[model samples]
Target: MELTVGPNQFFWPAEKWSAFYRDLAEAPVDRVVLGELVCSKRLPFYQDCIPEALAALTEAGKEAVLTSLALVTLNRERKLTADLAAMGVTVEVNDLTALAHLPKGLGFHVGPLVNVYNEGTLAWLASLGAKRICLPPEMPLASVETLARAGAGLGVAIEVWGHGRLPLAISGRCYHARLHKRTKDNCQFACEDDPDGLEVRTLDGQPFMAMNGVQTLSDSYACADYQIEALAAVGVAALRLSPQSQGFFRLCQSYRERLNGTSPAGTIASEVLRRLPGTRLSDGFLTGPSGVSWSAAPAIP
Candidate 1:
């Protein structure tokens, strides 16, 4: 299976964002999805750098796609979506509204943020000219297997969330702004402070989730260390690695090696721990009882 790099979920400095894509151009990834997905306010800061990044990735022999916003509420956001196709690159639809804006018969991709729960939804998107789809992180292995089979029969490539923190939900309210006692409109770009997002703790002080602008993510990073073999065997097309603040380039290499069978399963998790010490790794949503559970053992037969 090929390795696809998902769009960056965190709000990094414009320079940092440019540098990340510059380095990623040579990384061992097959596809790179760029553009703003969480908040539209973050776009202008790095908008000028997108063309350069796309050119670099394309020149480096990678399929680069522009992603649509996860939630298109404002008029400006809708206008942005409408103009995405004119960029002359594939557009990954995170919101259904983006479909209406896309020119008919223009091939597009479906992002994980959209609810693609069953074969019916999958078929519908396929009929609408969706070329590929990155399944949501919360899907169970059974559901993934079924969808992969369906996608194959329909000639649509099926991808899974392979690495990085799981994006659980997105909302209109900016949680980061609320934490800083500001309204969403006048939030002052509070999310830029936490590049990987701010961890949310429960009443008992346990890290439960992460807050990033208007997006809520899982505190534990979702590592598909053990599911790689099973997913490949099931004819899954690709594995998506979401961008993080640190050690991401190396992490991409590790996943690439593991996918090519030059490295073993769970080895990526080891590198992740070395780079991000104390980070909780979980693949529970793939098979375990809950989203936060991690199985040290191999895939269950």
Candidate 2:
């Protein structure tokens, strides 16, 4: 399976954002989806850098895609969604509303945020010119296999969430602003402080989830290390890796090595813990009774 880098879910400064994509041009990933996916408010900070980043990735032979906002609410947001097509790249529709804005017969891609739970939904999307789809992280292996088989027959590539923190939900309310005792409108870019998102804890102090503006993410990164073979065997087309602030270039290389048969299962998870101490890894959503369960033995503490 090939590797695909999903859009950055956290907010970062314009220079840092440009640098990340510049570095990605050399990474082993085959496709890169970039744009503001979480909050529209965060777009202005780094919007200008998109063209240069897209050019760099395109020049490096990577399939570059622009993503529609996950939650499009206002009239201006609708206008923004409508304008994505003008960028001259494939638009990955995270919100179905974005689909309505696209010109008829224009080919596009579908992101994980769109609910594509069954064959009918998959077929309909394909009919609507969806050339590829990255399945939601919470989907089980059985469902993925089914979708992969369906996608193959329909001529649509299927991708799975191979790595990064699981995106649990997106809300209209900004959690970061709420934490700072500020309303969403009046709040100064609070989510910008945590480049990788602020980790939320339980009352007992256990890492529970992460807060990035209106998005809620799992505290543990979802590593598909153990299930790579199983997914590939089922005809999966690609693995989507979400962007992280630390060691991401190395992370892409590690997954590339694994896919190239030079690295073994569990190596990715181990390397992740080594690079970011105390980082939990999970594959339970792909195989499990719980979303946070890890498959590898002697789980990293």
Candidate 3:
């Protein structure tokens, strides 16, 4: 299985955003999906850097893809989705609305945000020129196995969410703006403060979820360290790694080594805790009692 770096889900300065992709050019990932996946308001600040970033990744021999917004509501956003096809790179659709804007017979990819639950849905997307699909992070292993088998038959590559905080949901309202008592339009870019997202805590003070503009993410990073072998054995083509603010280059190397059988299982989770103290790891969506449950022993605090 190859490592596919998903787009950065959090807001950052334009320079930091450009630098991340510049550094990513040297990382061991096979392909990358880059562009705004959350609020469309964040696009203007860094959209100009996309060409440079895409050029760097492609020149370095990585397959570069552009992603449509996860929740496209405005007319401009629809125009943005329609314009993605003209970029000369594969478009990864996160929302079904994007499909309407893409040209007929144009090959595209599907991101994890799209609800691809069963064989029927997989087959339908395959018929729509979907060359590859990253299944939703919340899907269980049995379903993934079934879809992977179906994808193989349909000549489509199937990918699984291998790492990063699970994207739970996306909403129309901006959580970051509401937190600052501002409306979604006049929020003044509050989400940019937290590069990885602002972690939301429960009433009892436990880390519960993270807020990235309108996107809701799991507090614990989802690690497929233990399920890598199982996913690959079932014909998964790639493992999607969501970008984080810290140690991401190293994280890509770790996943690459793990896929190559050079690094053992549990090493990735351990390394995450070492670098980001208090961070938790979960694989329960794949092997589950609950989504937040961890498959390995708890990391030492």
Worst 10 residues of 1 by lDDT: 291-300
Error of 1 at 289 (Å): 1.4
Q: Write the per-residue lDDT of candidate 3 for residues 1-301, one digit (tens) a residue.
A: 9899998999999999999999999999999999999988999999999999999999999999999999988999999999999999999999999998888999999999999999899889999999999999988999899999999999999999999988999999999999999999898999999899899998999888999899999999999999999999999999999999999999999999999999899889889989989888899889877888899856548
- Model 1 C-alpha lDDT per residue in residues 103-173, reported as the tens digit of each score: 99999999999999999999999999999999988999999999999999998999999988899899989
lDDT of each: 0.94, 0.94, 0.93
Candidate 2 residue lDDT tens string, 1-301: 8999999999999999999999999999999999999999989999999999999999999999999999999998999999999988999999999989888999999999999999999999999999999999999999999999999999999999999988889999999999999999977999989988899999999889998999999999999999999999998999999999999999999999999999989889889988789888889988877899999745556
Off by over 4 Å in 2: 297-301
Q: Name the runs in model 1 displaced over 4 angstroms.
A: 297-301
Clashing pairs in 2: none
Each candidate's clash count: 0, 0, 0
Off by over 4 Å in 3: 298-301
Error of 1 at 222 (Å): 0.2
